[model samples]
Target: MTTQDWWRGAVIYQVYPRSYADTNGDGVGDLPGIIAKLDHIASLGVDAIWISPFFKSPMDDFGYDISDYRDVDPLFGSLADFDILLARAHELGLKVMIDQVLSHTSAQHDWFLQSRESRTNDKSDWYVWADANQDGTPPNNWLSIFGGGAWQWEPRRQQYYLHNFLASQPDLNFHNPDVQQAVLDNVEFWLAKGVDGLRLDAINFCFHDAQLRDNPAKPVEARQGRGFSEDNPYAFQYHYYNNTQPENLPFLERLRALMDRYPGTAALGEISSEDSLATMAEYTQEGRLHMGYSFELLTNDYSAGYIRSTVETLEARVSEGWPCWSVSNHDVVRVATRWAQGEPSDAQCKMLTAMVCSLRGSVCLYQGEELGLPEAEIPFEQLQDPYGIAFWPNFKGRDGCRTPMPWQSEGEHAGFSDASPWLPIPESHRARAVSQQDRAADSVLNSFRQFMNWRKTQPTLMGGSIQFLDAPEPVLLFVREQGDERLLCGFNLGDKPVSLNIEQLGSAHTVLSDHGLREAQREGNVLAFPPYGIFFARLA
Candidate 1:
């Protein structure tokens, strides 16, 4: 693919900076450490690497709460180290996409500090500040995703400020032209640094209702988990007024205009709204976000019908815009554990990778997903994620998926860090380490690499129109066609064996096979797939 369309149908590997690798032995991963692992990332046959936030922060919400937008955190490394990482990644033919948390910033950020000082300050209106009600309560009944009321009282301004996430992460007033310009300027700074693209965090939250209207309460059945469960009270409201404002469209156009100045660059937005699919469609329309993804697939729903409906809905809604899909990421439970009805298996991991990669548009494969890593159980005392600490037992937060990537099978902290890792590495994860998988031909890691490389050669699979075939419950069949090529992909999305007729699927020839078990052999035109089996064929 050319530079202009390189991100189209691309596979971008997501690397959570804190857990990827550590070079300084500070028990935390850094930019230099990422540079050290560039070769391994390239070996996966991915087009780009989306590194999570490494910006200067107080770590209240990890690196999501940025104190300095233009500089790298000391914990990650200096700006020079980041430049080296960009250079090395480009040398390996991997586009580097950095995180851009545009919706909010740490309360400690200079802008927030100045804005919170007094209403007369130049930056006073840069953040969402509102007056308290006559009853000395918040201006509205909006709630934070992290729990409790979304408003935080500021003594200096004698007003309440909105915080959709952690209180430390105060929402920015995107309605202010200056704030939008400043955000664009910060993005321009990275583009000037020769970065390839940006992963826009909470892009939907960029704009909020100007009137500060109270969000209506959501019915119990209408609620869906964005970050927290229904028990957190965050899911109790419709969230219509607080976010997903119509004004977000024009601001995205402004952001896209900035991106256009830097040729070959792309923007992949992370959207979480009540109608996330609809928002994704709107944000990715021409002249807005280039690609967009949501938490629809990351949820615990694993049925074939559910997956088909989700993709079909997005495909219908998103006309000119492209879609990016991810089954696992830093925020949710690993797919290996979430989708598995019982113990996770290597076959299930390989199948999941194949399924997501086969979809239209691009893909974001989370770090450690290649090894079929399950969520690591973190003890309450060892939990580092503040979200986890606040809601334990029912919702253990994101620490389970944020555990350090295991590099070596036998070593202190599994070779992620010389010192203790930020989060404890599960002993079970050691068995699936890169070192161990590198030597095994049938390992999940090897299968992922093979499948990814194989996908690159299939134009039909890369950028094809998908059509779901009518199949039984446990089996999902889809035909992806591009130009003259048509490839049919079938997956046994269950633990039990399934049987179907190849003739019924049309005249097709098996082109690829992974290490999936087949209890009964294919008889005549009949095909039998064992648990988590994957089959790829080309239609004649």
Candidate 2:
């Protein structure tokens, strides 16, 4: 791939800055710490790094609530530190993509501060402000993802402002042309700073229904939508009027236009709507987002059929855009724990990585995923996420997945920090630390490195069109072809072994190893798979 298209089918490593590494003994990771750890990230053989939010924020949503778009948060170092980090990453042949939370701003932001002070203020219309009913209720019945109503009562303006997320993270009014221009200006700041691309946070939530219509109620049996579970009241409604509005497309085009001005810089949007897959298709078509991904794979559904149907559904809807697939991120439970029938095994975890990477798009591998880190069990007393606090034991929020990375087996707090880390590093993770894995040749971390390095040698695996083959339960089969090169890929997602007859090969195939995965024994049309086994064959 050329410099301009480097993101196409690229393996992007996601680094949640708060959990990556802490250099200032402040119990939090920073830009300087990420810079210090660039060598380790580069060793993983990923094409780029996608750093989570580190911009100036109140840390209300753990840096997602941006108070200043152009400056780095004091908790995560300054602008100078970021520039140094960016330069160091480039020197190590790693592209840098930072998170851009454009849909909302911190309640403390100057724009919101001024807008909330008085109705006649210059920035009054900068946010979504609407009048309440005669009974003094909210303008609409939209519920916040965190909990409660999406509308917050601003006493100064005597009106409710929309906030699809937390009340502190008020949604920006894209209806205002000035707000649109201002958002683009903030995005241009980083692009001008020589950063490679942006991971747009909730890009579809930029515009709301101008009519302020109420969302339709979902049936009681309906459990989830827009990545929220039944535990969240936000899932009770269809969320039609509050987000994924048609007006957002023009705004995306405007954002795309800015990114085009800076060559080699792309936009990877994070989408979640009523129908996230369909929204991803619409958002990335034409001159909009460069690539898009939804939370379908991030959910707890782990099966061969579910995975196949999800990708095929998106592939059918998408015409001119690319998709980015990820099984693990900073949200929900880790893949090692979520997909495991019981206790997760190293072999199963490695197979999971290989499985997701084999899909037909770019991949986002979250930090600590290489070590097959299971989700840490965060006690209620130790929980920091407000969303988690609101949901409690029934639905433990994202704090479990947001714990600090384990860097060493013997060091205090796994060498993540000298002080007590923000979230406790699970004791189980110490055994899977980077230090321990570096010495073990058969470690999950080592297998990850080996497979990624090998994947680079196969052009078909990188950017090839995918065709999933029909197979039995716990077995995902597919064919990836680019030009004359065709490779048959299969994964046993279950814990136990199984034997199946796959006549799809027609016996004209070569069993290819060297991906450092468990092997599959073949006899004529019968192939036997071990626990979490992988099969790759070069088809003639």
Candidate 3:
């Protein structure tokens, strides 16, 4: 692929810095640690690596609340270490994408600190701040994703500061042209450092309703989890005033314009809004964001119909825009545990990976997903995630999926750290450690390698339009066709076997399968699939 087209149909691996690997024995993963594992990432056949935020932060939201946009956090490493990581990653033929959290910054951030210190300052207008109501209440009824009201009382300024997420992560006032320019400056800084792309965090929340109007209440029956708790009261509102403002589109265009200056640089906007899919379509359309992704597939709902509808809806809505699909990430439960009842077999893991890659547009594979790793059961005492701690049991937060990557089963902390890991590596995960799977031919890791390598050869699977076949439930069948090369892909989502007519697929030659499928024969257009099976056939 050409440099500008590298992200098209590319597979990007997301590395959560804290849990990936630790090089300084600081019990946390760093840039050098990622550099050391570049070969392993390259072997997975991914085009790029999307490293989660490593920018200077107070760790209130891990690294999401950036205090310094242009520098790396001391906990992760210095600027020199980051440069070395960039050099090593490029040497391995892997593009590096950094997370850019433009929606907000740490309260300690110079801009936020200055804005909160007084009512009149040069940077005062950079953050979202408004005067309280006549009755000493917040300006509006906006609620934070972390819980409680989105408005934080500032005694010094005698005003309320808007924070759509955590209060410490005060929202940046993107309506201000200066704020947009400063954000673009940060983008240029990273691009000049030889970074390939950026994964924008909460891209839609950059602007909000200028009127400070109260968000209407969303009845309990009309509510769904917005990555926060139903009990948190944040979910009670429709979130109209705080996010997905029309003003965001122009800012996205400006951001895209800045990125376009650097050839081959791409931007993947994270659309976390009330209607995330619609916002995703809007952001990626035209000259706004190069591409965008939402939490539609990231949710716990796992069904053939839902997945088909999501892809089909986006294809219908955005003609020129692109998408990036991810089933698992730093947030939410791991796919193996979320979709599968509890423990998904190695076969199921391979099926999931193959299904994700076969979808149109780009793909993101989380770090430990290759091992068919289930969510680690973190005890309340061991939980480090503030979200999980706030809503225990019913809504166990993201810590389950954020545990350390197990490299060795018998070593200290599963070879994640010499000392105690920040979070305990579950015993269940130890069995699926990298050391145990390294030599196993049928291991999930090897399956991922083989399938990804094979996928690169099929242009239909890599870059093609997807059409859902008329198949029964528990079985997802789709056709991927690029020009004259068409391929029929079938995936059995359940243990119970189901069959489909292959007359629509035309002449077929068995090419790929997760279950070692070799008994492929055309019986007058009636194709048969084994239990929990997957088949890829090139249409003649």
Candidate 4:
């Protein structure tokens, strides 16, 4: 495929910076560390690498609360190091995409500092600030995603500043044309630096209800578990007024227009909304975003029906727009453990990988996913995630999934650091380290490589029409067809064996299997699948 079309249905690997690699021995992963590991990432046959935020920050949200948009954080390294990393990634034939947190900024950000200093400052209107109500409470009843009221009283301005997430990370008023322009300038800065694309953080939270109205509470019946904890009062309201407002569409158009100026640059937005799937479809429709993904598959629902219904719903809703799919990321529990019934198994990991790649969208593979790593069981004492600390055993936050990438088996801290690592490297992770898997041909890492390499050879798998097949529960069956070529992809998401009639599917050649299990003989018409088996075939 041409470089321009590289991300179309491509697999983009996500690397969480603080846990990916720590080169300077400061217990934190840096750009130099990422630069040192580009070869290993490229060897996976992924089309691109989407590194999470490494911009200058207070790290209240671990680089998501950006203090500076133009330069790399001192903790990560300098702009020169970033340039070196970008050059190394391009040399390895990998496209580089950076996370852009445009919706909010650290309270320490110069703009925010100025905005919060006084009411009459030139940048006072840059952030979302409003006067307190007569009762001396917040403007409205909006709750922060992190915790507490979304508005924080500013003593200097005698008003409250809006924060959709953590109070330290104040929301930018995209309603202000200047704020939009400044954020776009940041985008231009990265594009000028030769970055391939951006994974826009909380893209839908760019705008809010102008009237500062209270959001209506979601009825108890409608409040089925949607990933956020009930402890986080943010889940109580429908979130109609705070985010995903209709006004956000024009800003997306403007952002897309800026990205269009830079050739081969794409935008994959991260949309978290009450109706995320519907919003994902809306965001990627026409001139808005190139593509967007939601928390649909990121949740704990591992059933075949849930996966099928989510994709089918998207396909039906979004005809003109493309979709990007991911089973796990930094925010959710690792799929290995989330889907694991008893003890974690490599077979289940391989099945999950196959299932994600088989879906009809561009894929995003998180760091350590190739190793089939389960969520690290972090002790409370070692936990750095405030969210985890707040919820304790109930949720465990996201620190478990954000632990350091295990590079070696025998070394201290899994060789992720010569010094103490930022987050504790789980003892369980050491067994699946890269060094151990590098020597084994049948390792989960090798299986990932094989599946991805094989996937690249098929145009149908790359970008094709998906047709859900009539299959039993726990067995996801679909056909990916492009022009004259068609492939039958079947996955057994359960431990029990399942069977389907391959003669009914016509004569076909078995092409790939994660278990290395050959297709069973077609006894008249039925073809059987063993536990956790995956089968890929092309019609004869």
Query: What lDDT would each prediction earn against the true structure?
Result: 0.90, 0.91, 0.85, 0.87
Q: Answer with 1 or 3, whichever has the higher lDDT.
A: 1
Clashing pairs in 2: none
For candidate 1, the 10 contiguous residues with the lowest summed lDDT are: 513-522
- Candidate 2 matches the true fold with a TM-score of 0.98
lDDT of 2 by residue, 479-536 (tens): 9999998889999999889899988767556545655578788898888999899988
**Best candidate, TM-score:** 2
lDDT of 2 at 342: 94
Residue range 16-121, candidate 1, lDDT tens digits: 9999999999999998989999999999899999999999999999999999999999999999999999999999999999999999999999999899889999
Instruction: Show where candidate 1 strays beyond 4 Å.
Output: 502-504, 514-524
Each model's total of backbone clashes? 0, 0, 0, 0
lDDT of 3 at 32: 83
Model 3 root mean square deviation, Cα atoms: 1.6
Count of backbone collisions in candidate 4: 0
TM-score of each: 0.98, 0.98, 0.97, 0.97
Candidate 3: what lDDT? Answer: 0.85
Provide the lDDT at 182 for model 2: 95
